[model samples]
Target chain A: MSAKKTEYGEDQDLLMKKSDRRTFLKGCSVAAAAASAALTSGCIPSVAAENSEEMKLRWQEFFKKNYRLMTQEEKDATVARLERLAKLRDGLDVQMGSYPPLKGVLYGYGFNITRCEGFMECVAACVKENNLDRKTNTQYIRIFEMEPGKLDPGTGDGQYYHKVPVENKFYMGTQCFHCENAPCTKACPTKATWREPDGIVVVDYDWCIGCRYCQAACPYYGRRFNWGKPEIPRQEINLRQHYLGNRVRPKGKMEKCTFCIQRTRKGRLPACVEACPTGARVFGNLLDPDSEIRYVLKHKKVFRMKEELGTDPKFWYFID
Target chain B: MQLFLTGLILLVGITTLFWGRARASESSFLDEVKKSTARFDNRSVPLVKEVTEDTVLSHEKYQGGSFRVLARKKNIERYQCSNCHNDKPVTVNRGAELTHGDIVLNHGSAERGLVCIDCHSPEQRDYLEDKKGRKIDFDHSYDLCGQCHFRQKRDWIGGAHGKRVVNWAGDRVVYNCTTCHDPHSPRFEKRFPATYSVPLD
Candidate 1:
């Protein structure tokens, strides 16, 4: 290839190797300058505008898999695995990886599949919340089709709609329905994918060696394999970093739905739940009978995606 | 004006392709003037020449009957475009297989009129097997339909539409558009307001 004209300046090659550090500093400097400039002329990067640090961090970000599938000991081991990784990550904000241990956290989710429309808004939100790569986006929530009221479970295309609003055809989204007895963890040769406290399932992204066992063990087809390091623009990045979930995963991690643990465990709803326009997603403490999830369970005809396997999945679908 | 809609549809469709599964064929079954002027009779089909309120179009509309026509790719297969459409709505694909949309989704709205093609695209089809001996086409196929039924799309994206089954840890996942509707006709799986989850103010 011919020597390409460069937009990054003289040391472009040097800049490429240490993109994380240089990009972060550049972003911070840009924002700091922008804020100061804004104070004087109101012409800097506004709060609404993209954050350079966040944007720079976009390509480097990743999400861990279902943490809910892990047992206590393995979960702690997984936490340690993540901490070790934190020390080496490129754009580690506070401390690339080395930080605190997993604390007491809780997880839970509810869905009205009868109400699901299959837009993938939640996927986008998951990407943002977890700082996922723009390319792969890691999370594997595919919307499928089936006979309505028939409930054959994740059998349809999940993503193929031609003319659209395929009425009379059923729609169902498949994600890591965090199960009480997740089979993925059982099938793992290495204790990589595990369930976290608060019920969200997560993976030690660094520890995963790109094996497809967890994915195969997942009857729900909830797991994902990063075939390639995600390809994305640095400017389109998300940098509000988290240690466990989607704060920049690497090239070959096995990932799945975390119930937006980074958000939900902190009292916030997962991105998808909030993005649902139909309110088909009902999120709350499942243990709390008064919670909306409880109402859904009591009033709606709900069933797990797969009953024969008896994964004891936490995720359920309902029809009214 | 129609071109403006086409432009938007194109933009949305392209984005949708990457956002979704892969493809579905399309037909010129539903259109406003076509539906009003009318050619075919009853039984509701996608691309009949005539138009009516009770039925879109029937088998009498075309002879070849849902065959592939777009120069044919290697493994890609096209279905009868009019199998599910009719002139009462008149929607067709204009490229943007990315969205895979092809018709207008009323979502049980009284205001829903013709312009069905406004929401629907030509439907992208790719059955190509990948290096892993598995399919490598984009996922999220329903995104094509979500272009117009944006509210539904939003819900789907948020793990509301379709299945939205969540983790044992918690929260029902969101869905995509295809979970409920068929691109050819765009109807609900059950009754009116197929999506009762959305508020009706």
Candidate 2:
């Protein structure tokens, strides 16, 4: 992988590593010098001395290693720093943790089209759970009310439908499908987004360059790009977070649904699944034969959104 | 004062005796139901379809169909039917003067020509009755429901019909029929949904 040459006529991997190391060392030395100067100069405080914590946090944020490359200690330090920053900025005492996927468990979701009443309870729960930008009304889940007997989501109306569960209309929801052959991951210029071992497509928010390539590549309109800083009220912030899932994202980053990685990896159901009053959503391990998802796939008439595209979405829609 | 105290003690003793007896009978009945369900769950029926390698390669053992459904007796408004029908038996013909005016009876009553005795046991106001006249506890109302809606009952047992609550990993716990549907009027009412998401386009 390192031997490959690019248009620049240099080993891109080597060049990138060298530049990263140089910047990291430079930042460390500067922070050290500033700390010592602050300790020594008691009378005339430097600018770094006044906002040392903030400055250190910024430096650390800039120099933080990629989540996949971070050691255990580094991950812990990063989590602690993020928690502190959340507190400082929004007065939120957020708890962030990284949970690995369970062994022999591949998560899958089934949507019962016949049962969904277009309640949109899942949408509201998702917004609160994922800490989406309220000002822009950023949402990961969209419930599309389609004409009866039609399966095309493109023609469905997401906004105008009222008095839902109408006589002939059926509701279908869309989110990140976490496809096995995810095109969004391939479209990423920086390789910041990839499918996890448990088949959840996740994005490293820090590593995303905000190119919006993944957004264009996605056929289902799964990814959402932050146009501005997310407006999450301090009191409304969900403290429980995962590094790759619902952790508070910054401006100019890309994010999508991770099937509630923080909750699912910990053996709990996702907030959306629990919030659906109509029992339209079913989530479980595909590897478990007795799981409700597997049962639906076996017994019900099931179909994926875009089978011709061959994305191999883990999501399935079924009717009674 | 001495006579009053003696009478109070006697009354307490009698109440305790009756309570203990009732609890013992109820628990024994539940145990019997559990045993029967456990046995029934173990009997294997033919697979709905052949399990191919793609479906069952990494699949764990099939350990479903034995979950407890949520009980709705506690959530029912003015639950104790015996409070009103203690001394008198509830007759089916008490139409205009029916005490339960609030109940619309739009479920099977209007469509399938079902009366109160079709489900509720007249012999015991609190217990549900099957076609065979067996009394069913509120917790085991699925048995009563399954008698008529066989397909839905089959799906419910197979973990396809209702909602599973809490953890998705361990034993599946689901909500009962009454949890979502009112017994008198089983149809769900249409209403405005939750907050709308702004159009992304």
Candidate 3:
């Protein structure tokens, strides 16, 4: 009995040593993260920063699994970590949505060329809704004021600085078309971006290597890369975020429109569609036979941009 | 005119597609017209032969009918016009100051010479009147607008034109034509865009 007791005591001591080594390694990582953050941001209080929750979160975040491969628990953990990080870094209580795509729902958008009137309300709304980088004034949607008889957007002026619906000039708004046969997803070496079940093309910002290969492969100029860290004002940041949508992205990641997935997956219209005053923007389930998008597809003389490329873009343009 | 021609062609196509069903329901369609005419009290507006209000109004089994035309009655600034425009004349008459001084009637072209009384009911100030002397409720202003813009009305009903409020899925509630365009001044004026891109040059 005494020998057994002595053996148990020895096991306890060994366990103690192992735990001590783990604590030391953890402390070292936290210190390293805290130091790097302090050097980069230069705002964190040094003494408390080493032991801060933020440093531990940053260290954990670096080792997170790819979003698609993560199990439900892992996804939830990452979301919680992200929310905590948002609070710790920016004092934001952001609710990051992780809504799965609804069954039998494939979204399609219809743009009325006759009604757009070159009003950039959609662009303005998108920027606000998506929490686009205000410093760079990053805009996802662009309303091109096309010259009369020149329907080609390549020749149109996207930056018309005067009163819109300029007499004869028609307007065309363009964004990420969320093509059925997306070349961007094929071009992604890291498999960072891919089309969702409900037809939104999304990027796992954490998985992206910032190669910009997807951007190059895109024929519609859909993707935008972060050259510097996205600087969004705290007050201006949209509190309602999605894991793959409008969540605050880190530096050196690619982002484009996800048809406001944070809202759309919850049965809401895209921000740009809601903001269009002239009712030019039409969005609905392409699968629904009675949907406005389907009616437009059947009745209207609809055309898709870059159809020759076999992109099979879901977005359609129609004139009155 | 070109729009009308396109609409006519499309209408022909629609008529052809639904020809059998439409033919079988001809008697019921006539009965529906008679019913609506009786309900209106006074009906002189010529109903479009191709389309009818019954098809648009009824939540028919053929069409997935979970949609509503947005009600405009609640939002109107000055409702119950009969309260002020009662039979009694105002004792204090402020000369040259019309009751609705802000109103500038410019609906049709200047040559068309459309006055307030042309659309606004002289008999009942609250209700709008079509060319057929039919009184239309403020909530159903689309009925009044449809007298001239039938093609647009058809498109709106079939979900081709106009805005659907909020949701893209589930029940659709569409805005009235007057919600976007001022009935008095129907044309959208030229305005500066809300935002612009940074010059890429």
Candidate 4:
């Protein structure tokens, strides 16, 4: 079998080796089928003989290269194939595009602990916006209602709060802070999860090896592993997707919040920020001094969760 | 015949005086006339008093503000204050049997010695009244709210208080103060959130 060489010679060699192994397996399977046919009275059915569109798609998916290594043409082809796969599997006409980070903008978020009414509007909006797995009940943003005068998240109760904005209690929300010094990216063996130029930590779903190392390494418990196929209802699926963001995640992949990359990259606010009724959530460019996030940082008493770790999280919680 | 004519004229004059007093006290006669005429005339009378062509005012264009504040009139729930109050002159002393009986003015009554007319315009029930006694639209409620909550108003202007909507970049459109807080009862009440917290095991 002839092998084609690309710019990534090492990756090309690996691909060639994989193809060679696959051909060898195919030959072995054929030989095994012949031997079985000779032994049996009737002709044995060959598994490889039934080549369907789905089978071809599965093969293409298996051979798909890492997102980082993919050429522009390869990326486009992969996006097309993924779109086709989504349509075939879920009947969703999803528009998946890889949006590059905006120039001269580093996205940062601020949460007013005083203003957050413990209303999970942001959480609900996030689940819908990101197309998170409904079966696993996957959520990126977790609002913890803390006791009065206590700032520690360790003592905060995320669950079992009957009523929100409980007297003397304040709410603090946590998500992927998109740390400037992200530990998850360091822990990722496949280099699937990394921070973009605009400071959003994103996971290339196809590239993730489902090792859960990132999950363990993350101090904020930001990453989520898809144990099974993300069971999203067909009608509820968000068609607007970023390739590295809220795109329909496959099973056994790690996923996290990308700050609504599809929306934010286009100068729109994140779903959580828009959904917040109390204006508790603030998001804007950290670079722009005139931006709301900058104003909050400058005026309010802002603190990050696990600040001692020195992850340098872009997300900050402030009190009026 | 002369006595009968004089008695009839005197009786008619007394009746007219009584009718005028009744109309003045309770302007329901005009409402009744309107209701009766409305059946025949399909065109409904305007609920809000028509601002004369000369006195008509437009909201000052917010130029170079950090964010574009949304008009409150669009967002007010069950906003038909003028429906009942248009023809009726608001009595200064309604004797605690409030017209807006549901509205509990707990915000400024205890601390600031404020009444309904303090913020809300007595003449225009739909619009708010500012410290300068200028008629303010419901859209510009921040002006009225800013009178007392100056710190919060400053924070809002500076982007620390209130919610911003739509795109974060470019023209920011923020919710007005009255959008989240009820002017009658400004405190945010404790209630069940939209979704429950996912238990972190």
TM accuracy, model 1: 0.45
- What tens-digit string does per-residue lDDT give for candidate 3 at B27-126? 2211321232111110122211211111123221213454566666667776888877899886557534547778777787778857888788998999
- TM-score of model 3 (CA atoms): 0.79
lDDT of candidate 2 over A1-320, digit per residue (tens): 01111311332354467657867786886777667656646656675465667667766776776666666888889888888887776678888987666765668898999999898999899999998999999999999988987898889888854777887888999999998667898798877887776778999899899999999999999999998777888788888999998998989999999999888877677889989988889997776667777778789999999866767688999999
**Every model's DockQ, to 2 decimals?**
0.01, 0.19, 0.25, 0.19
Q: Candidate 1: where are CA atoms >4 Å away? A: A1-106, A136-139, A161-163, B1-201
RMSD of each: 26.9, 22.5, 16.9, 27.5
As for TM-score, the candidate ahead, 1 or 3, is 3
Q: List the residue pairs that clash in candidate 2.
A: none
Top candidate (lDDT): 3
Q: A1-320, model 4: which lDDT tens digit per residue?
A: 01111322554465566656766776776566556544542443354343244455665666666676567887888888888887776677989887566665678899998888788989899999999888768889888888888887768888745766777888888889888767898787877777676778888888798999999999998877888777778788899887888888888899888999888877778999989988889997776656677778778999988877767788889989
CAPRI tier for the interface of model 1: incorrect
In Å, residue B100's CA in model 1 sits off its true spot by 36
For lDDT, candidate 1 versus 3, the one ahead is 3
What range of 10 consecutive residues in model 1 chain A has the weakest lDDT sum?
A1-10
Q: Write the per-residue lDDT of candidate 4 for residues B76-178, one digit (tens) a residue.
A: 5547678667766766576354555766777765667667888888888788898899887787788778877988987787788886656676555666787
Per-residue lDDT for B1 in model 4?
Answer: 100
Ranking by DockQ: 3, 2, 4, 1
Worst 10 residues of 2 chain A by lDDT: A1-10
Predicted candidate 3 versus true structure: per-residue lDDT over A1-320, tens digit per residue: 23323543564465466556656776787678768766755665664555467767878887665676566888888999999998887778999967677765678899999878877999999999998888888888888888888867889998788987788788998899998768898798867787776778899999899999999999998788877667877788898999999988888899999999988877778999989999899997776667788778778989999877767688999976
Error of model 1, residue A79, in angstroms: 11
